[model samples]
Target: GFAGNTIPIVAGSALLALRALEEDTKANGKITITRGDNPWVDKIYTLMDKVDEFIPTPERDTDKSFLMAIEDVFSITGRGTVATGRVERGSVKVGETIELVGLGNTRTTTVTGLEMFQKTLDESVAGDNVGVLLRGVQKTDIERGMVIAKPGTITPHTKFESQVYVLKKEEGGRHTPFFCGYQPQFYVRTT
Candidate 1:
């Protein structure tokens, strides 16, 4: 009972804060709040409606090319190498060709199969979490943080720029600066 009321309120507040940050940054996306039936549901619903009023729908890329962010890579005895992740854009069909782009290299491969929840699928579209069986690639050649996309649609970047937001400063003392070549373990899309 304690959590039922407090959790929704806290989560709703956090979402509202994030929405405000998005507005400050002029970001393009809507935040929709979904929750179970609870005492605070009405407040969350009101907040959701208020946020949705100002947030605009994200623009969809017109390109028909497909892309998936690789989350796991493994090999099956009869299936060769399989890469699993959500299809981030477009659609990929069972027999289509795609390229694995990452780690300063790219490998073109054919989609031998696609499966979700152990059932085979003829095609997988955006937002679908599917395991793709690839031909002519070994398990060692693929890894997490790689992007699977239609050939020629994506190119590996040698260097890129990004903005970092430090959520919390160290409690004890001043924060140390990270110099060039400081490698941190990177996690992307649950990988």
Candidate 2:
């Protein structure tokens, strides 16, 4: 739940950091960074009696097929394009054909490399934050919410409807029902 709130906010903010792997030979990688710079965070936590709780790692949703949410995308000057995010499920290896699906953009490319914490990896599974180098797609080809997965594993949709409950002011939620043309935020994995 912490990651659910943190990743999307940082993704939209200007604080997303893009780094090159030198010791880890990073072609590209994106990491979620939450700075406790908020003046209210301490008070909020102290009021809840959980002052020691920092950023909580999301529980890894281990599965059988490869899935990774695109947290960041950038290009290395001489090598190739890199996508970085935590693997949500399954595993992917170098040279495996993967599909980028989201935001009405679907493209196929081969995974040329994966690097995490500056070290190269042969494969990345759920819970590992890694940067994946691609063979064909350019940095401009993908977006933050697009997912990298085994080809045919996902289908992209342009629109979908979800049910949301409007809470009362007594419950610390909005007191009024949404008016016409109200748009709510949707947080799906990293995107």
Evaluated with lDDT, which candidate comes out highest?
Answer: 1
Candidate 2 on 55-104: residue-level lDDT in tens? Answer: 46566666678999999999998888999998989989988999998877
Q: What lDDT is reached at residue 60 by model 2?
A: 64
What RMSD value applies to candidate 1?
13.4
Cα error, residue 70 of model 2, in Å, equals 0.9
- The positional error of residue 161 in candidate 2, measured at the CA in angstroms, is 2.9
> What TM-score would every model get versus the actual structure?
0.61, 0.64
132: Cα error in model 1, Å: 0.2
Query: Over 4 Å off in model 2, which ranges?
Result: 1-63, 175-177
